[model samples]
Target: MFDSEIRYIISSGQRKKPICQNIVLLQQWLLEQGRCVVCGSFLTKGEKKPFGTGLKIICSCNQVYFYLPLANLYKRLSQNLYKL
Candidate 1:
């Protein structure tokens, strides 16, 4: 459900994107689920503050999942262009 919502945000491509906060929320949700995001074995949250615009999580399968905002990516790029 959460993953699907993130995908929807990407597919929408309108004016909304998955922000860092949203990703954080997703991580929390996944933690509650107690399931890995990669192999669905088990989930282990890494203790690290959100840097830039992404979150990092490790699964029991030794798989790492990084959640980054979708729309914010382009928005950030456009902002950078304006600075140039």
Candidate 2:
């Protein structure tokens, strides 16, 4: 599901647009994944330390999503239908 959404966003524009540039957007993405937007950890991982993707996102009790590779993602819309 996530892949498709990402693909749609990238495919439609076909431009190198940063996937996210603010905290709100990041939190929304994490929330959709059932993760604590502030902590950036799966809610199912009870009592376990929130091992964030990197030290940058770690925060008190919750996480602050800082980075996601979606940025700079671009897809070429052209398809070379002709065969050599």
What would the TM-scores of all predictions be?
0.29, 0.29
RMSD per prediction, one decimal?
Answer: 13.5, 16.3
**Candidate 2 global lDDT:** 0.41
Which pairs clash in the backbone of model 1?
A: none
lDDT of 2 by residue, 3-82 (tens): 65764345246744445544556666665664666555564452322223311233346433332334412111122411
Candidate 1 weakest ten by summed lDDT = 72-81
- lDDT (10s digit) by residue, model 1, range 15-75: 6555665676665665456555445454334332244576444444545444454532211
TM-score of 1: 0.29
By TM-score, how accurate is candidate 2? 0.29
